[model samples]
Target: MSWSGLLQCTAVEKNGRTVISDCYYEGALKLTRPVYLHPSQPTIYLIHVGGGYVDGDRYKTEIMLQEGAHLIATTQSATKIYKTVKVPVQQYTSAYLDDQSVLEFFPDPVIAYEKAQFYQEMTVYMKESSTFIYGDIITPGWSESGELFRYDWIRSKLKIYYEDNLKLFDHLYLETSTGMTGIFQMEGYTHFGSLFVISPFMTQDLLQKFESMAARFPASVHLGWSIPMIPGLVIRVLAHETHAIETIFQMIHQFIREECFQEEPIFLRKY
Candidate 1:
């Protein structure tokens, strides 16, 4: 079944200096239920909904954040792109952040079955003082079913903008036989994820703290935090074990929550 929905959030300061709006979609199969979360009175809301895909199934989501507002959005579970003999399954997501606004888009993960093809893209617009933390986890195939890295193709792109100026652009392409043993490849890792955190308010000391915490993990787990082009930190990890990667992500998320939001992480309780 094909389904679609949109989510919008707007914020305005009391002095009426700034205004912004954020919108997105949450839709999937009709058989499953959509997850919802209302964190604050009128500022934060999280919704996650997805379902099985058969033939010619399409999923799309869009999010927009108005100026001066803060928003965090996450998925309840990883999205599964089922393999089909006839047509390839598609999932599209787009996000917009208004001037002086912040948005965090971190989905659970995307699981691709053998012979499945998937495409994804994420775009962000930023203004001065606007911050965004975005990431995604991708797995080759279901481990429980004895399936290893057997997907056909998985492609992703990320674009970042500061006002009318472009800050960062990235593209990634992966396949089952992408060579997991090479020095620059996945290096025998079955699952991988990338995290990008952008904020001008971050200090050198804080960056050091984050890096130190990341060093506690295994050497195989790649971690890097920097402010090379953008005023934020980026972490990339590849692990042969899914749980290990998940644990590291959870820890990093919690650290950011405490430092940025001054609130406890919510996903731990929900998971």
Candidate 2:
């Protein structure tokens, strides 16, 4: 597929700190200046200059980290997918993490408007000693009729490979034509959030922490989490509003940062 925008960036450990060593971007995709919120870790925000994705648009991204490097990546704002006339907007991202590195990717939610179609896929390659954390949320966009789930469909796929072997593969397809509120579907929930954490720190004790967190939420929100075959943790949530899911995800992220990485729970500084 011909991409309308392309973004490539590399981070390396230099002088005991991680920094963006190389960056190349064109078309609609760009990145903000690297912000060092925590001395050793750099946070980068991905931006889409086009404001929103349109039909027949394709975007590609590549992120690489050298050995002993750690980086945090996030988006400037929610990804908006507008109504399509011919085809769905597409995006593909590939990330590579070297030995003993860490990559925390936390992007904003995706809003699919009425008659909108969006397809996204991401793949991560890492060594056994590296750590990877990714989080995403999907919410319906506004419509004139104020109807929920008015969009056409959304297809999202994520694949993780560790030590050159596939550790996790998750594919989610939600189609309005197939009924999103019935059994086995979203069950009337208007928002979906997913979090994946792959690191040696994901242990049985971590599961207990997540269990306690789930117990705090009300019945309006549903939280489901599990430990995959690999040494990782996966959590999924269904809620009526975006804040309900984001609050829980942020809590877990903060815990992992302070406990596992032994760093302060800092903010991304969205405001």
Best candidate according to TM-score = 2
Question: Candidates' TM-scores?
Answer: 0.79, 0.96
Clashes of each: 14, 0
lDDT (10s digit) by residue, model 1, range 1-271: 5444434445443353323333333454221122223233132334444454444566555556666666666665667777767766665666666666667677767888877777777777777677787777887766456867666778888888777678888777886676555777677677888888887756678788887787687776765555648678777788776666777877887788678768667562245
Global lDDT of each model? 0.65, 0.91
In candidate 1, stretches whose alpha carbon ends up further than 4 angstroms from where it belongs are 1-50, 54-56, 143-147, 218-220
Report RMSD (Å) for each prediction in the order shown: 4.4, 1.3
Error of 1 at 250 (Å): 2.1
